[model samples]
Target: MSASTEQPEHLRRSLSNRHLQLIALGGAIGTGLFMGSGKTISLAGPSILLVYLIIGVMLFFVMRAMGELLLSNLQYKSFIDFSTDLLGPWAGFFCGWTYWFCWIVTAIAEVIAIAAYVQFWLPHLAPWIPALLCVLLLLSLNLATVKMFGELEFWFALIKIVAIVALVVVGFALVAWGFHSPAGNKATLANLWNDGGLFPHGLSGFFAGFQIAVFAFVGIELVGTTAAETADPRRNLPKAINSIPVRIIIFYVLALAAIMAVTPWRLVEADKSPFVELFVLAGVPAAASLINFVVLTSATSSANSGMFSTSRMLYGLADEDHAPKPFARLSKAAVPSLGLLFSCFCLLLGAALIYLVPNLLTAFTLVTTLSAVLFMFVWSLILCAYMAYRRKRPQQHADSTYKMPGGVFMCWVCLAFFAFVLVLLCLQADTRAALLASPVWFVLLGIGYALKSRRAGKPDQAGS
Candidate 1:
């Protein structure tokens, strides 16, 4: 693609209401649920259901706060915009770049996951091949137009929704019929409590589950990035945000419950996906392969979302002079081509990581833990910005049509919950390493922000 004589100044608002809805849906249902739920079920047992509920409810409030703030000013393209406006330029600088890193880390994990999924069919295939191929395919597709990305996510999310619904329905029928697996495990609701019960592994196990479960929700806030291109955000954004709880219950809680009921919690494989195993246990002909294909697409969908989000974030940062000025340029399609290529170049490292890390699960946990920790920072910044918005813009809050349910109080509550999850990260060895490495990102960002401020001959708000 080449630049035209007439260059558009901004991203086009071509994404429609349906696009926003499915994008939000795609964001809400992340790769973690499909790829990581087995480990969560094994660690937390049936108590994992309660874990999802707590996280879901808390994130719903976070979304509500984000929605209110984004709608309060149409000028805000994403949460980073509000972070900068409500907090300071330093907040925007840090938030924008950290968010960009967050998605890159997440896309790395998704690519590794895609390679693992491919190995289900070809056990000897080089993991890097699929990983590299996925990145290149996403780069080509995203470079076309923003609307194309939306269309891809729309279908990807739809496939996931249908697959989960089918899994639930089939699981219920098997349980009703008292279907017994080859291993002699009987299908029944009693499976939830028959073995060591919900907290069988104790509270320690339940707490350990949060580390990976937090990764499950990594992309939940993705819709916030669509504010710039979404058509009728006021009408569409609220619709997407309000339905999060429902989607969580149906897509996550119900699907996992059905899987556990069919296969029993004790029998779930830690490293393998339960979504595919459930069908294999039920003796569904070629069904496991079909489900594997669904999960592959699911991971691909997540990688696509990551690519779209990271490029746009870089674009936002450049437009504000927080990044290289050339990153601000757009292609004929109104897409940030240079930023997208830069993100893809970074993603290629993920392929190398796959080739280097012999233990796939370890690589996944490391990247995901780091990704989750950064995402929590981004979420905290949103809450902090919401508190600032409340203090600085009381008149706007009072006059606004859609208000956050608990306002500033819930912001504090969400922030506290995040802090607690961060503390939980210290429990495990793998997660602890990621946690220890996290502060280095902030240190680098602080130094970069200070230098940039000095070059511009402005007060270093980041240092202040």
Candidate 2:
């Protein structure tokens, strides 16, 4: 197939249903769940499970709305395009740019996480070395071919799945068989509620957990981004998206329940990962090393997905004339070569920053909070796009096959929810510092957009 002059048809629908399913799973399950779950449990106690379920449901509906919009127009390759066409040029511009920023910030976090994970085995190595090497590896894989990216993600996701399944299985055996710990104590489900009674921290704790639990579901909407590249999107998209609820329940809720069952929630250390703790409690000496490797793969998978989605978003923007024409260029293998390289270059900044500031915890916290804040911006834009679709395209709404369940009402609700989360960020001192730092990022993007608009002799065509 020849590439289109206006909008390059570079992405081949080569991804199978299995690939789409696993991609969605990989996007949903990230290093956040592996490492951050301990903090969430500390905040909400056992009630964090409810927080995960709630955020998952809200995001599921959000994804459904996104899916309906994408399927309504086969030409829509990414949410940015749909937002631009349905909402306006400004919505598309803001959504596309913000989403790109989201991934870039997320990539930084993933790289930092990879360095931290590597420190488990190589404590003396400089963090920047692994961080730099990881960026190069993912960059090479992503620049190869879309199919290569899919295959790479498939295997990376498979590792995460197998690791989680193993943890859950071992946890169950320890709980059921009454396996004694090194301390001569038998494991049981009573650990979940015995110490603090599930919500020991009370309603405030449960509410506080929502602030972080929502972060775990940050990239779940990535399934829609793969629509243009998946073979038979109509069949595979729904199959991948429809299974989101189940995945949320099993991976987030059940996985947490299993961990809490085997080990008391209070005993779960905030500094250590729950997955690592599970193996240790189950009397596995190598559990820490094993879980560390799994988390490293998880971080790589996240960074890989971030690179893929960001490049496609840039490609879509270029097609709409919102980005430079060069970004629309494609290699023989149908990969957005320029966009991929651009994103990879942006990732290298993470390595440089790590070199300048060797404090891993400070770097990790800054990148992670920035990523979460930017993701919230992206989610809010999606809700805004849905609201715009309702206002401007009532006919499309009437003719649509699959519609967002609550229409404009729920759009407002979700937007409100997003705003609340932002406020919570301000309430927390560490997150507040990150949010304060975020404006500098927006300023840089705005300056670039302005310069590009002037060069093109257009009135900021980004969102129009």
Candidate 3:
């Protein structure tokens, strides 16, 4: 294909390398590390770090495979589009809609969590107020130019990065300077395994952590969805992807290690945030207030990312004729206005649900677990798509600029790892409830697809 033939005028690349870099970083760091780490530590003790490392390695290869497929076809704006072309319509439709649902569900949880975070300062305030404000704030931001979205995400991500770096630095200082609690214990690495080895709860505890550990990595693939708008995707895309492993190690593994070192893993509370607890333990009277600010921003960043990604997924689906054509429309600023508004409207349901169910913990558990289930489904599809691509396009595989190492074998391994995580979900009662509740989403998608197919069969416009 010639250069002009390969490139399309309608699709412009507007994201710079800096934007791509920060997008990847923004995608990786979220409420998971800021708030969810406490729960994960409670489940598996210090061994949770190992679980995170394993999951990170598996997802790294999965992303490499996706990047390889995406870089090969300029027409592929998202993984779902590439899957459809390489596999079939079914793969495309399923991947696109499922991934969109994943974001919506995850966004709802983030919004509700944000409301809860805000309540720390204003205990008497109504939750719905903050949730509504968050939705509107993110919606307005998303309606602006894609470059503006990139800029907003850059600052949001910077806050998270700086917070984590500060935590690590302060934690190490406490350990080195021999800071002691009233109980007379100095912070040190010994906290990780001294009380009862790393796996204090035993091997079963380590395995159990996988259920929540996987959720931490849910939005890591957001970089893949941004390919359509990335400037010089060939160079910038690889640079963004190459940072995944390093970021995972820094943000998840090392960050967690530092937290567990400063305080014993067993002391971390499942219901309270570990970041807040670390500050409180360090004798900062306003730690709760400071951490609340960080958690609030983290929640906003996650919701902002959800809106951006869900809209792009809709745009890709429309481009592939899997979704309504209206969703493909772009605003003057190159934003997917229709899709953005639709997703923002859907997010309002989160506020409504929070009003109905005032029990914050219960509501958070239901939405987040469901989000994890859907994310697993999407990741499975990516692995399956890669496997299909390898089988059907051997020559493309041979000449690809970016390739998945140990192609077929790694593909199978990732798929199996996902399968194992699913089984673990089923074994855990909370996650199992989510698994039972998730099929309704697929059923709804099936009904929608059937109606759409019927509408397209009419005589008015079957032939383009």
Candidate 4:
């Protein structure tokens, strides 16, 4: 590689506290909460609230560990950087590539989702058009500058925040007024337990809820990735991470509680959005259209996040010689242009697949399931890295102002929780297939790592 190609330009620190906070907020709230929560409700009943609370609490620890590690060393770009330093190069290779692939798969799914959501309005339009256009739009915004990507996500996240807040507020009002639905069921807090109690589906149903609910929290660690571009992460990152619990209570718990209070758990359609269902029950004008637009932007926001994260992950990998050097090269805007384009190109192929595949929804389910499984792996690695940091850098942990609560003990707890979720995946045929198919990715990574290591050795041999 030439010196010019190895220019030391790095990710800019343009994202302010608001961007970090919203990005963190956006990561916490995913499309699954919008489109997939009904299935969770049907599977777990009112116990679904408990399921989300557990996941949120567990993931908050994961984020805290991640935040502490990142702040411990400002030179670290992401968790991948810390993982590589604390664990080994192999850890970095596997975590980096797997994370990159995870987002690629997620971005593709989001693209497909965007197309399907568009079809709700433009029934006659081809699915690929909107999917392709969505990718192009995100690519353009991300390529412009880091702040532009931040701004795009800021508004995208704002829309979701507004929509969710509206749902909760309206839902509470209906319950207060003792509003009755068209089905003659009164909207009240009793709806949460009136049917068959919170665990109406039993422990098995509660366990089943973990399978889908885990996916809702897939992007929760995304704030860690933005550490490089975030301005004053020391002050801002903690603020974002510490507020996670409150956000979860408001966004997931309160919002879902409101939904059930208005509609009842048994009444939520497993295949449809409870958010839209709640609005329809509330007699909102054009509720379907309104919720449809919110979900569309939600999907878009998720894809935008995937694009930004993947490029940065690739850039980080390239900086460590885990990927091609060109990926590390930045545009005039300090954006990882090549990696962004590469990820978008993969997304475009997903658009093409949407045109070709007859059963894209089924395929999408498998893809998302696989993504959820892999994300757990990444989260596990974060905890593992945290444990390693605790053992290897006790001084840093001791001196740090923002040490992870529960410390290494929480790491074990979080890891065990992920393992439990993985076991639950086996109970369902779809998730079981995804769980079983996950090894193929690792097998491929092992082979790639060995080859890269051997090739690295050859140059050293010649020089000696």
Which one is best on TM-score?
4
Enumerate residue pairs that collide in model 2.
89-463, 89-464, 90-463, 90-464, 93-463
- Model 4, total clashes: 0
Residue range 253-286, candidate 3, lDDT tens digits: 8788878888878777898888887778778899
Q: Ranking under lDDT, best-scoring first?
A: 4, 1, 3, 2
Output the lDDT of residue 351, model 1: 56
TM per candidate comes to: 0.94, 0.92, 0.93, 0.96
> All candidates' lDDT scores?
0.88, 0.83, 0.84, 0.91
Q: Can you rank all candidates by TM-score, best first?
A: 4, 1, 3, 2
Deviation of model 4 at 119, angstroms: 1.2
RMSD of 2: 3.1
lDDT of 2 at 381: 73
TM match of model 4 to true structure: 0.96
Q: What overall lDDT, based on C-alpha atoms, would model 1 receive against the true structure? A: 0.88
Clash list (residue pairs), candidate 4 = none
Off by over 4 Å in 2: 1-9, 359-364, 443-464
Which residue runs does candidate 3 get wrong by more than 4 Å? 1-11, 357-364, 458-464
Supply the global lDDT for candidate 4. 0.91
